[model samples]
Target: MSDLTKLNSPELSQFSHILSHAVKVPGLIFLSGQTPTDSSGKVVEGGIKEHTAQCINNLGKVLDAAGSSWEKVVKVNVYLDDMKNFSLMNEVYEKLLPSPKPARTCIQAAYLPNGVDPVIVLNHPGQIGAGYAPVLDCHTAHIACKFAELLEKIDRRTNKSIEANPKTIKSGDSCIVKVVPSKPMCVESYNDYPPLGRFAVRDMRQTVAVGIIKSVEKTDKSSGKVTKSAEKAAKKK
Candidate 1:
């Protein structure tokens, strides 16, 4: 077997049917392109700003997991579905990355997945201490196919949520930024959280999972009794 070591996160593994989050071979680490998606692989609904934030947040998570950080990045490749959003994406990108920014390139592509734009790839030097490799990098792409079933669940719940309050939500607008999975807890952690807005988790996927958190809330509009079965049925549908 090649001495290549694979780096993966439970969150990324949740989408393993599509791609490996990252692959490492001592001196180099390669990360897959990250799109704005939740833990269950739902495409984020916000515009390019949200998409860019989600992409960078996802990358940062993987880099931290692999013993590297943005400061170590030596190169960057940005792919945009349209050139018009170039300035907007850069505004967010520059603010998030550390000083002495890495060499960079930006290009407009004919298309990007999930109708999303500005997929970013970071190439950085990995941790080189005490026997670990010294170079790291990452790329991301929108997810599909592998996420069909999960998407179905989400869609069903979304339909149910809309049926509950058509006026309050015309489209996907709410997201669950924080989840206490073990406790079976889910809530709208952020008020009026934008669709596909970026959320993150640091150092604890076991206790918490974060991304573009989105979920359909099932509550009785009149009596206000939460419908547990309704939510479950929606997910099963």
Candidate 2:
């Protein structure tokens, strides 16, 4: 872990600008964190209103690049450096509107320069099938059965009762049955991982169930050492 005390948080004079002239038509114009700065990137001597207007003007150039005006933007996201100046920003912001106003949200999320993907968690140790994973770069087979046994032990210790999440994210939330079967017994989807989507179901290994669960495949050889492709992708995520 890095030292938080040594972290760098510089007081920026002006926020950055991005421009793309390739795509035409109704384009997006981002008015980024417009701090007080002059045309030469120098700090200007003015109030927040001046800096805010400059930011709006800079966004106008971006809008012009697509041969459309700022009035064409259907959406707008605002960044408030000074909460005290929010009303000032709003008053200036309303000027950009012609007849219909853009949909807007007022909050303090970071000023991300461009688009980004949503992140998700993987290998949740508390989740089912997660215990089967090898720890600390250890061999997966060595601890694979340990994880399975741990489940049986947990069931017996906890009276074999389990609860299913009503609005579950995955099949791992399946309920565990306490009672023993009479004959031709089968528990339920008690060993399945949480459904991650079509990708997870598609990339599941046939051998994980056959070899690991049923012991049908010889795992003593390197050829037998394999993991679900979906699990690999999940790890990457």
For each candidate, what is the lDDT? 0.45, 0.33
Which residue pairs collide in model 1, if any?
A: 32-139, 33-139, 33-140, 33-141, 34-140, 126-134, 126-135, 126-136, 176-213
Clashes of 1: 9
- Give the per-residue lDDT digits (tens) of candidate 1, residues 1-237: 498866767654254433578777767778887878765556567888888888898888888778888887778888997899999999999888889998999988654544411111122122111121111111121211001111121232222222321121112232111112211122331212323222222221121112332333445547744421101111110
**TM-scores, one per candidate:** 0.48, 0.33
- By summed lDDT, which 10 consecutive residues of candidate 1 come out lowest? 228-237
| Candidate 2 residue-wise lDDT, 1-237, digit = tens | 231111111232222211222233233333333333444444355665666676676556545543567667777667663477788877877775565776877665432111111112232333434234331111122112212222221121222224332122232222211111111211112112111111111122222211011111112335644322111111111
TM-score of the candidate numbered 2?
A: 0.33
